[model samples]
Target: MMVAVDSTEKSCLSADGEDFFYFGYGSNLLRERLQIMNPSAVLVSVGCLKGYKLAFGLFKGQENHWGGGVATIFPSPEDDVWGIIWHLKAADRQSLDEQESVKHGIYSPIEVKVEQEDAGEVMCLTYQMNCFNYSLTSPLYKEVMCTGAKQNGLPAEYIKKLNAIRTNNYNEITPFTMQVRDILQHLQINTSE
Candidate 1:
């Protein structure tokens, strides 16, 4: 079931004027990917959103910039989605929304309660696809998610689940795919140093 965010929850999410918490389960799970646009984001903790399952889909019959499906969450009583909690400056909110294509109506911002190991339950801002039309993600896109999952130390079982997701296996070179590859390469190099 979808939990509504009450006024109290909203206050708690942004108690301070400067920052707020964001739950990232998709490509945004990667620090480098997020920082490309929202540089002020900082890793706060890892958390799990119960009663939801990870899904990949095309938004309104349109493929994502990566030329494949993108990640979103759906309510599922028996499932849980693990992801990173990022604390970001309030000023970065617009950039984050733009990154998620909020203005385009591809994703809608929602509030979710995430269970954190040390902090307990906290309300955070997350996005869900407006329309869920199942589609396979590209191999490179899935690889980025898997790499982020491992980087954040998510459970082995969850990582395995992420890896098991079938890909479109798109190998044809395109500008969008090339851009993603370049970003991944640059981020990997920076992390190593």
Candidate 2:
């Protein structure tokens, strides 16, 4: 799952030669979620992605999970998507890409400008769904988004929008999905979300 990076961004690597910035507009907005796979992930800032809107239309191909869509960004001149900026070791980039399903061609990384307080703007890699067919969202997935949004302290209005989103009550048929539900329950999560 090699991602062909243009020579331009290759110049932005950190001095240690293993750090890169990422703009998280989706579930990865949750530092904890990203940390699950990449422990070195650090939240550098929070900001809005201008000229883009959050969309839950990217279908997940993973089996025995939510039969709904995940988050991605779409062009919208009138909107801004609130998200977090993360810095991780460059060594974990491929693992992060795999987590986002880059090998399956589900998402592709691209450089985008994010506006953060004090920092003004920073160029970082973000994932965008290449799938065109829009779909519904799963309730559990929505819970993750809402929890993540609140954890990052996004705008009140944006958080409300995320909470208000409708989701499909995707039944747990696969053992993995069921176990996920069990874990959420054990943790006293808001499954109704």
Model 1, residue pairs in steric clash:
none
Tens digits of lDDT, candidate 1, 27-108: 9878778888999988877789999999989987785667688899999999999998887878888888899888889998
What lDDT would candidate 1 get against the real structure? 0.82
The top-ranked prediction according to TM-score is 1
Badly placed stretches (over 4 Å) of model 1 are 1-8, 12-17, 187-193
Deviation (Å) of 92 in candidate 2: 1.0
- For model 2, residues 1-193, the per-residue Cα lDDT tens digits are 1122222325333334567778887768666667767778778777788999887775444432566888889889999998888877877887888887778888887778878855577777888987545667887777777777887788899999888888877865676556545545644455355
Give me candidate 1's TM-score against the actual structure: 0.87
Off by over 4 Å in 2: 1-17, 59-64, 173-193
The candidate maximizing lDDT is 1
